[model samples]
Target chain A: MNKKNNLLQCPNPQTECKECPIRKMALFRDVPEDDLGWMQEFRNSQYLLPAREILFRQGETAHTLYTLFDGWLIIFKILDNGKRQILRFLLPGDFFGFQVNSIGPTGGYLHSSLALMDSTLCAFPTTQLRLMMEKQPQLAIRLAEMEMHDMNLCQHHLIGTGRKNAQERIAFLLLELFHRVRLQKQNDYDESSNSIIFPLTQEDIGDAVGLTSAHVNRTLREMEKKGWTQCQGKYLTIRNEEALSKTGQFDPRIIISKPLI
Target chain B: MNKKNNLLQCPNPQTECKECPIRKMALFRDVPEDDLGWMQEFRNSQYLLPAREILFRQGETAHTLYTLFDGWLIIFKILDNGKRQILRFLLPGDFFGFQVNSIGPTGGYLHSSLALMDSTLCAFPTTQLRLMMEKQPQLAIRLAEMEMHDMNLCQHHLIGTGRKNAQERIAFLLLELFHRVRLQKQNDYDESSNSIIFPLTQEDIGDAVGLTSAHVNRTLREMEKKGWTQCQGKYLTIRNEEALSKTGQFDPRIIISKPLI
Candidate 1:
């Protein structure tokens, strides 16, 4: 059970650990029930954020870690000239803002993360996490595995961003999100929906894929004409998965399901 | 202390763990001497690889992890069309080939590694490392930190690959390697040496930067004409670090000196 926070206009101040909605997909799913119970005490609050709200800013001193219990988020960096690069997308059950100040007493985030849609996150104090990790080596292992999994995903994104053309890149991104959503939902995912629910704008796709928004729009239109997919607004329906896969030269094998703890 | 293995034609089979050339720069530098001593047993074998030798191949089963004792190595992935992309470079004191098989029983190397020069490596069986990790939880933390450091590097590389121009990309990479070499060899590095020893060919640079050899050549020549640096066979001297940094928009802060473990 969660207590509603009246002052902050937060939906819940505390969320029951075992009954959490994303418990099945969360990082601690593999963690033992006893260990998970320990985390229940550490999760002090849950914050509900509106779309475009920055969860953390680049160069901001990171003092907490958050679990994205629901909704979409993107971690990005802005250059001195004001150009932005989307580093990685954070899905439900993902961890964010865990940059530990290991080298010195003060450290800041290398990238900024903003909520792509209305989102809920369970916040944990970094100090408590470090203490819990020291007490439970297995917890530390899970955290390490999470970072490894993140690294693997970033490497895969590198291939698409560096080598693939605009069309292939967009196709690859769509397919990746599709598979990720499928994994999170499993058989419960509604096939009748026909299209994947994506909250990202074309500019978001362009930023993520390292292409200009104009180029992304042109590529999506070309794919639409080819009958491979229908990309309208925030929804994409893959009419021909085979063609998209072939065009992107995408291999799902590169994606690590989970990191080995 | 370690015993010399007579059967293997190794240069040094029994290097005292404390006196290890990379002991100071190695990941385990933070580890207590007693805990660090445990690694002496794993340093049972050493392999010297000549340039162009493939240490491991993509899709091949990964059985061991190696620590580079000397010389250079590059981890790369080759596309279906045989176009290669350099994933990361391995230097002295760097760990290589720690592939976590989380999905299923059969797991392969995500990328292939080739020796860029005659390199000496101390090899350790992955199984033993895993077992050691179980016994020494701290070792697992260090390993995870290494992977995070790697991911940060890849993300920075991604920015260059996706957003930067050909000349900027080349400048950025040179600055990166120069800094890395400087970090690895702090005071012992000879002041008499004017240029950084770069064993990479222009083609190698091209693969690393997501460019063609011709493009890399043109970029290098352009930088040369501007009196930026002199690029000779296997050597690159930064004649003007300030100009190169400005052109590349290089920030050493992006690099993780050591990941927050």
Candidate 2:
């Protein structure tokens, strides 16, 4: 795969559904083992999106949905005035690309998704969604559960931006991403260390938390000075988790919902 | 039904599924006529919530999910600092009460819901959702579609609070509510009139748009002074729809998604 380009179509044979490491946490988590072959047939292909590259853009006709196999992505909307609002931060095991203005064949994506790091995604044709749901009712239930989870996070962010101050918003966002990364149980997270691989820039943080990059920078400095957190060399260390949680009013329990399926 | 208390148990017979006035726009919109009787059996009861009454509170154990047969409601979360963030404005035919931290039987609501006006709601047991979805897969598909629609609205609000100015946020919210009210094709909305029965107070607008009541009031006055809108005697009239849409970057098409079922 070319690291310089936006996206590269991986030439390797598609990973079997039964062998997928992330399947246990994905959209098909509830499908029985016997049904793995059927699901594998439905998946289109796997693609690699290079860091800082857009996987898809807003208003583009959407033909596929993707399950993040690896890496981080941001789903965002750019306003008419040229400002961007980050709607969601996607981590591995996250299923996305379903937000659209219409469900019709010609419907366009409502937001653009860009990879924060080189990401691998398992793709599925949008046209098969309904049929697949009908065949496996559990999938629809899982989708509803997933959407509810995403909605909960969206509301949490709304609370942060709408009611919380800059310090609170930044703290809440950092804690949220931290908890989410840990939840994925991936290799990047080390239990022995107090830090995770932080890929978001100050501007990205500002877009997600509704602040200017300068404001985010100042708040980060304040947080660092207080010995609550450290964001340097692309790593975020939670030196004082209790203090940060208190300041942010964040409870990690909110991210621990069980899969209904 | 008594108007003095928050909730009133109506003695009136439950409305039959087939006879429900708002069924076409509700959760059971796509249920076949022959299936209405089965759905009616699953419905528990109907209750009345008087204007300015609490329907449910955050952290309360949730046993029932509701479909608003009539009237307005607001879903909100209150911060520890006593601030409130209005998440979604519910309209007639809107189904809600499923926002929970967990889907387990002991799950509690993550937000509070309040009736903005005299409202009637049809109730269903939460425990029956999965069973019913299994029996009627179309219902599950319909639910996912509804959730996607709601997620879109939530994302829209995120953008308003994160990127748009006070004027733009207010304009966008007003236009959004206006368009949604009109879409219902109900008695409250008159084809000849440019106004709907606006039930929200300035504080409500403030909470939803991430502004202070004073700021919302000032912005509304400015918009009114410019001959763009009028808010008086519980009515909101859009005198300049085009200009308001331009300012808000609002598009009616976003709210006109086809029901996937």
Top lDDT model:
2
- Once superposed on the true structure, which residue ranges of model 2 sit more than 4 Å away at CA? A1-5, A101-106, A186-189, A259-261, B1-5, B100-106, B186-189, B259-261
Model 2 residue B72 CA deviation in Å: 0.5
TM-score for every candidate vs. truth? 0.91, 0.95
Candidate 1 C-alpha lDDT tens digits along B96-200: 776532122246776778889888888877668667767777776777667666777888888778778898889999989988887777778986565888999
Off by over 4 Å in 1: A1-9, A100-106, A191-194, A259-261, B1-9, B100-106, B191-194, B259-261
Q: Say which docking band candidate 1 falls in.
A: acceptable
Q: Across residues B212-245, which tens digit of lDDT does each residue of candidate 2 receive?
A: 9999999999999999999877899999999999
| RMSD after CA superposition, every candidate | 5.0, 3.1
List of clashing residue pairs for candidate 1 = none
